[model samples]
Target: MANTMWRRGVEWLAAAAADPRACKWEWDHGEGIALLEAGRFWDVLTVPDRLGLLALDLLWRPGLPVPGPTLVDTAAGRVGFFLPPDPSGGWVGSGLRYAAKGSWVAVPPPYRSARFLEWLIPPDGNGVLHPPGPLEKALREAHGALAVLAPMCGR
Candidate 1:
């Protein structure tokens, strides 16, 4: 079931990229997961809103935790992982913010390490967020695949 949904996500992304009028999108390659953002509301709305894209399950994966209180801004067409609060005023942990405008940012260390830095990419191809155990290798593969597929999609 999960695999089916995942594959559908990949297919939808590919179709969106193939359409010349499809809005631009990007993703961040970070510690826990890959965060994706589509520049226009329609592009992103087609996924979570209309298609009901499921959240990637990461419970069994060690060193990679599912982000808490994830927020998707349907209006701004942005998605972000918010850091939980601590006893102190400061954020207890780090989080990620991906804007459809092609900007990705992550809260720096103490909150999290440099590994959490976001990697931006066009919204095409397969965008899988492999767990932390094999993050580096997975990212390389995903990025390479996206690069090859992006041009064909008119990205």
Candidate 2:
């Protein structure tokens, strides 16, 4: 089952790459990461680690729908959530960056860790992506929560 999931994850990721063959080759040849084009299969919504961690906590509570694939760049102190493409490109918030249309993203293999990057929530191999509405709400709520805690932390 693990192997099947691993292969499916790889296939799912590769299908989003500009050249799926090359992407698979790179992953198969021990490259450890594949640079994939954004907006092909999904758009990436990135946030600072400070806000993202809090948002994740809220999203993961029981009875909430599971969020799509999420990743973190430890060295960069950023977290990225995969969401379906938004033609309007209307996502807007403090500290939020949308990668879509022409942007690129470095993605680690679903089953392994990479330097400075790792999957917080690995892709489920079912092409699921976070819905923009819920994500925006979670992020906004997270921002508000952080604002409340900031003074308490002397920030």
**What is the C-alpha lDDT profile of model 2 across 25-142, one tens digit per residue?**
7766766789998887889999999999888888887877888899999999999999998877788877889999899999888888778889998887889888777778889899
* Highest lDDT against the true fold, candidate: 2
Off by over 4 Å in 2: none
Cα shift from native, residue 3, model 1 (Å): 29
Candidate 1, residues 1-155, lDDT tens digits: the string is 55565444444333324332221122223343233334422112111211111222222246664323223335434343322211232212122222333433222211112342321221122343323233223334444565687799898
Candidate 1 Cα misplacement greater than 4 A, ranges: 1-63, 84-146
Error of 1 at 106 (Å): 19
Query: Distance (Å) between predicted and true CA of 26, model 2?
Result: 1.8
Q: TM-score winner among the candidates?
A: 2
Worst 10 residues of 2 by lDDT: 24-33
Distance (Å) between predicted and true CA of 64, model 2? 1.9
